[model samples]
Target chain A: MASNVSTKNTNNSNKNGSSSNSVISKLKNTFGLQQLIILIVLFLIYGLFAALSPAFRSGSTLTSIFDASYYVGFLALGVTFVIITAGIDLSIGTSMMCAAITGGVVYNQLHAPLWVALLVILAMATAVGCLNGFLVAKLKLPSFIATLGTMMITRGLSSILSNVQTETFPLRGTSDGWYKSIFRTSGDFPTGAIVLIGVAILCAIILNKTRTGRYIFAIGSNREATRLSGVNVVRSEAMAYIIAGFCAGLAGIAYAATYTTIMPGSGAGFEMDGIAAVVVGGTSLAGGVGSILGTLIGTFIMTVLKVGLPYLNLQPHYQIFITGFVVILAVYADIYRNRKKNQ
Target chain B: MKKKILFGTIFAALLLLVGCSGGNSSSSSKSSGGNSKNIEVVAKGFQHDFWKAVQSGAKQAAKEQGVTMNFVGPKDETAIAEQLEMLNNAVNKKPGAIALAALDTKAEIDAIKTAQEKGIPIIGFDSGVPNAPKGAVKATASTDNYKAGGIAAQHAYDAIKARIDSSATPPRIGIVSQEVNSLSISQRTGGFIDKMVQLLEANPKIGKGKVAVTGHDKFKNKVNASSAKAIIELRVPADVTDAAGKTEASALLKKNDTICVYGSNEFGAKAIINADDSVGGRIGNTEGKVVAVGFDSGKLQINAIKSDKFLGSVTQNPIKIGYEAVSLAVKAAKGQKVKNIDTGVKWYNKDNVDSKEIKPLLYQ
Candidate 1:
């Protein structure tokens, strides 16, 4: 509202005040209005939970909140790119588990080092992402159908590759336990939060300050206009999927670190959680408008609610019920914002 | 351009067929070739490690009996319709005998009735079909969940008795259950409460009405939490996600008066262990700590026992359940008198966790 008002004033008044208004608009553009709103909602929810349950205010609960966020955060980050391009990737859930379990296989059966196994997990998911890209972008299949097929494929593939067994990761104090420390040290430091934030910053740069980023936005807003403007829409669109795939890979690692047991048939409903976080963060499912900042705050909001609800001794069902309301309200807010922008 | 589109459609259709066929063939490949009798075994779909261990035992039994065994289940445990479809398909296959672990027996009445009409011997394993058509389930190979829960309580009571007796205020014993909807889980949870209440009542300091049973409505007694000599709190997460489970477990661990905590199953056990990581050194039999007793065995639970964070755990013999179900099915197929099998449970701590007797039962 402030930016809109200042712009009108600048057009009506003299040139002297235009410079300051322009700087203010630029500052507002960097953080944006919707993101700031969601950020406030995140804090408000935290304060409410804290007020209701003293245990929710403890440091350990904060760690628990972070523990829940790592994988979902990475997942929301990756899918943000795909959602921005107006395409959905349903396979990220199963594909993430498929890649993680395969990485466990590589570590256990092949005796690969931990770092090598992590790389294999990332590569495996990216490969699936590439396949999703090929089907949706090149073959002209709808993104939904393409990802749905891959979702079932990866679910079956994870079971087959691991022989329907639960793959075990290293425990704390083992030689390769250092990998678990990527998410948290044994002393209870949540290093994974730092890693999640750093990655978010990098993704923000790629989406905002890069050529592929502009193409993704342009393709989402007007595909025909982008093609007419001689942009390589196919390659740019494919990069979004690749990024999503890579993020799912990162999520796979985070999941293994936090839970330490990656079972077959895991990751079935996980895509919904990531997609929910993205939409709640003010990213329009209709596409062409989103921010990594919104997604980061969105992930925390979901996690804090999940982790904090237990403090009130509320059952998991109630938490799910409340989260359903939250998602609907966030989407409604998005619609309301869009309507106002148009008017 | 039209011809190319036709070619593309055919190519994609072929690929889809190939993909489906590839998945189908692998699952079907488990049964043996040749003239051997085939036995179809359907177990619970969720919890891969437990089911896989059972399958391993079934495979060994199939080899010993010279019969081909095919095991299958629905993707989720609560998928009643999907489980019914699988049961129907198993009956339709006309195998010599069928072994079923029904998630809901009434929902599977039609398929169970079909198997009985066809004179196929039906054996139950795990939480076998209870209250099925008169004699539809000829025998069940399962660990008595009530007895199993009693075993977990007996062991846990021994370690926490002194603390309960000595505390000025009523000491708290916490039970973390994954959920109370399932029969086996409810029985185990109920049995634990009954057994613990018995033990506390037996003590002179805490008589019958002095002990409070609180939490979910299914298990709550009339005794109030604050006025009681001892509190037995039962917590069940609304769902089965690890995060929810962890939160439930952590809540129990966080209470100051909590002297002992017990997790009902592998999921509960693993949740307690994960919750312990965030809380740090709080789950042990020491001063200002909690003693955690777990049911079932997973690597994390096993590690907890070895490290002395847990008092020990009660392990259900999944392998025996699998082996016995297949063995009984073979006998019944040959028209021999077959009775229900009771695959029992055992209590193992750090000392015997890796013992030869117990090691095979722990699937990681």
Candidate 2:
């Protein structure tokens, strides 16, 4: 086991050394060329919208952009782990919504305290993630099929739990509305930005500096080899799913805080947004390579497109069309870079 | 061991799916069986309290009329394909009659035709399918959405007209609609914009300057937006979520010259109220307050109206619409001559919200 760990470290360092031999490759290795390019694209989109509509240039518009990012950001951050392990979680979107709906029911119908309700949201999401992990890690089911079933289950459960009613959280001025401050201040400052950044940094540390993180990367790179080396590959892979689930829980809370109402079966397409963010942020769907920072940047790029398109006097359908093109372009860029690197 | 666990997980998932579908089928069967005539009512979705109230009303009508009403809806309003499938299923059941709140007017034409071929009379409710095949639809029970929007506009204009007269600069009126694609929302928004423009054009003082209506392209072409005195800005979000609506509301609220705002639906109303809360502005007819008028009645919108956070709102008669739809369907099933019914709408302010006429129509 000790030799395996040392050998993995040496392999990582050797790759780093080779990539740093050229100035361009050094920049690519250090900052991640894909993330840098996406960041540039984010700024360009912002600039384009600002140029098109004077209303888009205001602080409120920026606040709206930040507000839209919270739930998607957390979902992207969590699912980055699953994707990093060469796994998919189609359930995250609906799971987050289901968790939020559960919390809403607890708070509104059951008259539970806000803290208990928040914890319930986290617990529900974590259990779902564990289920996904158990199905994939232990049962060896395809991640796609496992999460797809879980997605339908969670969505259906959410509708059943809320009785098909739109569950609303406490508004900002209400006594129990302090939770809204976690995402935005009463004064309308983007306090959620600070929380998102803090969470991103914490996730970065866990992904880069922790033993569990190393094992996760190892399992993703080669599950068979890692298991042969006597690592607990199942547990490590399951832990990745658990982390994804926990992140989804946090996203549920963010969603409840940011929006006025939670509707059942409304979150079906949201996972695609999170997955797109992960991909755009330079996270490989094949796994073994990803960063929390890249996912964060990717999430902002998506929100900017969603919130910015209206300012350009473009219809909402145009935003969807442009987003499709953007995803294709980003993935193409990734493919091009990989080919160049191999050559 | 791995194979066993995999099979177990698959089995569990299958069990869950079977359980859900089983529940649906049993409930539907319970409604369909017995001596009572079964009438399947397909709704847009049960996503809102409005729909639940509609379902309750339908149930009430079914109990009173000695008929069995089977209500089913897609999980969300955007599930057009799912809704089509539900309509097909309702037709396959060959129910006495089918009452539908079609999500897409044109998309359901084929289903309407199918019901026609199957000799199942179709009654349209909430939103009528205007372009359905000839003789396919027997009657429609719906609130006059266009007139309801005009009522909202009339009340809003009454509140803000004083401000319009006093202000030297061209004041702005903002309309936040949930979406432009839905016929119900389009009519509501169009009615408001048209009424506001007509009112402005009638007044010589306001008519001195041009009235420009700008926002979504479909609405922009409906009114003049160039060289305007009162700029009627119509904003519809990309989607039907509160997040999208709130973004549009906040943008409309940012302009200092804006005097009044109208939210065309429940989602839009909540979005306006939310934007107002975040932006911290008075929403009333008093000096320096922006008049906020809304449509539909939800707890949030009702409370906002009661608290003076909103000027007023146009409340749709969803329950009556539901009852009337089922009643008409039952009558049509009996081969009785039935005509279109206007369930009507009421403009409820804080004073009239609890009034005898408006109290029962308010869903929560």
Q: Which model scores highest in lDDT?
A: 1
DockQ of each: 0.01, 0.02
Quote the TM-score that chain A achieves in each candidate: 0.91, 0.92
Which 10 successive residues of model 2 chain B have the least lDDT summed?
B13-22
Per-residue alpha-carbon lDDT of candidate 1 for residues A1-343, written as tens digits (9 for 90 to 100): 3432333223223212345656556535533645665677678678766655443566656776787889889999999999988899999999999999999999988899999999999999999999999898889799999999999999999999999877877766679878888997767688999999999988887887678987887777667777888999999999999999999999999987776667787798889889999988877787776778888998998887766553443434556767776777667666754564444
Residue pairs of candidate 1 with colliding backbone atoms: none
TM-score to true structure, per model? 0.50, 0.50
**What tens digits encode model 2's per-residue C-alpha lDDT throughout B1-364?**
3323433443344334323433434433444423128788899887667788788889999889988677877767766645655575566556789999887654455457657886889899987667777898999999888888999999998887777888999889999988888678899999998888899877777783478888778877443555677789988788778788888899988889989999998898999988877787646656788899999888999999898889889988878888999999999888788899989888899899899878777876
Clashing pairs in 2: B212-B224, B212-B225
Residues B162-269 of candidate 1: C-alpha lDDT, one tens digit per residue: 888788888899998988987888888888989999998999989878899998999999998888999999988877899998898889888888898899998989
The parts of candidate 1 lying over 4 Å away from their true place are A1-31, B1-364
